[model samples]
Target chain A: MDYTFQFGVIAKHLPYLIGGAWLSLLLAFLAFWAGAVIGLLGAMGKTFGGRVLYRVIDVYVVFFTNTPALVQIYVIFYGLPDLGIVLSPFNSVLLGLTLNCGAYLTEIQRAGFQSVRREELEAAETLGMSLWQTVRYVIAPHIAKTLYAPLSNFYIWIVLGSSMAGIFAVEELTGRAINVSSSTFRTIEVFTYTAGIYVVLTVVASALLALIGRHAFRVKARIF
Target chain B: MIERIVDEIPRFFTWYNTIFFLQAMGVTLALTLIGCGLGSIFGFALVYGRQTRGRLFTPVRVLIVGYVEIFRRIPFLVLLFIVLFTTEGFGVRVSFFGIALIAICVISTAYISEIIRAGFEAIHRNQWDAAEAMNFGRVATLRYVIMPQAWKVILPPAFAYFVMFIKDTALASQMGVLELTRVAKIFNDRGYSAFLTFGTCLLLYFILSYPLTRFGQRLERRLASSRNR
Candidate 1:
């Protein structure tokens, strides 16, 4: 119980850690957008495609969602080399996260698709709305309203989840913290600071997301 | 490379290795169950604390809220490191498994408390008023009225969180806990093909989680339908 605090050593490495924080955000942003594209397609296929297509996407979603992203990345980063396919740690973590995020987002976006009632679509059609107009004025808004909060929450989940990249040597915020703690031998202080950074990073991300959701989608996302 | 993996398969599934993997899976499950089980209890306590009224309870509510908001935002990996190092710094001789359990419990309590709070909030305010009119204390009201209704709403998401933790406990491997991922790392480091080792690790996790997920979905649907009725 006699451990003295040592913020002084970690102070010099603040910029390095900040750079790592930026990498964490960049990683989450990239994976989220990439996953969104995959999820959109998967949701569409599951909702409207043939049974075979539905089954394929279902399997992908099930497999990815059920497995840990860390192990999935482990398989990709370590196991893939056995099959003559090697990826950089960053690429492997990104690929793992994208696939995992896609599975969850597929489920989320699919729920959004289901939330659109048939009556609403029929009403738009009865109003003489074209396909694009119906999609724009009726369907898009409906989906956006239903999906915005969960999507933002998942984005923040990805931000937190991206800490897994540190284990794979990605040099993100957690990775840099590992480096500093190992080098400085200030394990507790280093991790405490890293956790603080993560808390601040996610709080800011949540607030920004809440603001965007409020204005853009009219969804009352909670900031805290 | 393919041939190498093929060659390693027979060796990988030996009786000893099979037992090793099964034991590792047990550790993973134990971590999830113990962690989330404790989490649910502490989470309910947190919800109760936060729901208390009066100026005296304001700090308690704020502290509970701050714990939830801050802990939920921190990544599990960082939390693990913090727990690991903090325990070390305090010179407590905790096992790696104990460290992992502490981290999981801390995070799950934060998350499950939010879920429990939302579940309680799902009950109508009039229900609380009715309980108050009957002279029921907060504990009595929660026990007799709110929990009966709220558990239906809480069970599905809480169960989903449990399943999520099954996969997440894989990170415990990073801190040298001999969980499934650690087993895979051990086998792979022992000259086994990574494809065979980690692939089996992935499949084992899928086996563990997929059924619980299906059950949670079914529970959600059933509860939703019954609630509507």
Candidate 2:
């Protein structure tokens, strides 16, 4: 099997690849933000709400945990249209990934929420803080401290997981690799180059997340 | 349509296709399991390597960091393609199945190593001193004193990662390995009821993974309670 490896042919597709990387960043960031907000709500519901709410959140986590993110994406990308609900490719992928991340984040945040000491809550109450104020000023900060590392880790996980968006033709970095591989007929070369791009993207994302952890959460995150 | 899908199941469950998909699932699952298993070993090795206080510790530390970063950064799909086509020389052509398994193991090792490292760090320092005071060697300490405890702490992360590994198997489907997702794709292309086909596939994966998550949660709770006691 004589196979010629040509860098030039694939090199021409660099711009598109870069664009895909940028799109991936956008997808991940949006999903991260959305997941964070929903995670907070779900965590709070599970922790503070009645049994029904807790049960609801429990089911949510089980469903999301059990299903593949790719399957989630496919369900939204392909399954929804069958129900007469048409979503754009990008929106469908983003929605799917965000919801998936939210479920995982909800579980992580719930752990953090459960860790806030009862004495701390009592102290907040003794200081005449309302329930909302106690949660806002006291509980949230405590959860923030415990949750920061896992949250950052989850952010990185979602960023890497977003590579699967390629399957949906969302024009993320992985999708571009598929295109490049088919066009170049150099499946190995195209994917290898894409692999390098992925490494850079993940590294950059991890570093940026670490920086955010330092500045935003004021927490020292040990990145392994 | 639902009745049609019900009928197709027994037809699709032919001897040849059954063997093919089961073999495919087996190949995919084995690749991930072995990859994760080897990765865990390497990961544990790094954890112990880091614990060895020495002048060369800095480089060892950097190597571990570099390993995790490199593997985690690259997409598995790309790794599969590259390793499958390349890495053939000296009269050794690594099979597609081989490359897929090796690639997953390579990636799994990086993550597993870090998880093991974290588990080690979570162990109280005094526990080591207690083991040392008992005249236990490093191996003995790890095996008898540390590992049982550390495994509990690591179970939540490791078990969660196992589920991630199962999901990651879908990526190999793109490389022409007919796993669940691949079969779903084939069914879709063949004008099978796409809804029933994919819905069933999704259900199958859910059935497989949900219990693992629940089991991990239970183990985690038990560990926490025992630690408190």
Q: Which candidate is the best by lDDT?
A: 1
What overall lDDT, based on C-alpha atoms, would model 1 receive against the true structure? Answer: 0.93
Query: TM-score of every model?
Result: 0.98, 0.85
> What's the lDDT for all of these models?
0.93, 0.78
Q: Evaluated with DockQ, which candidate comes out highest? A: 1
Provide DockQ values for all models, in the order shown: 0.87, 0.47
Instruction: List candidate 1 stretches off by more than 4 Å.
Output: B227-229
Considering only chain A, what is the TM-score of each predicted structure?
Answer: 0.98, 0.88
Off by over 4 Å in 2: A1-12, A130-136, A185-189, B1-28, B49-61, B87-92, B126-141, B227-229
RMSD of each: 1.2, 3.6
A116-210: candidate 2 lDDT, tens digit per residue: 99999999999999999998989878887898888777777777788887877878998888888777677767777788787887777677767
As a whole number from 0 to 100, the lDDT of residue B132 in candidate 1 is: 98
lDDT of 2 by residue, B158-219 (tens): 87787678878877777666677777777667766566657766777776677776787788
Clash pairs (backbone) in predicted model 1: none
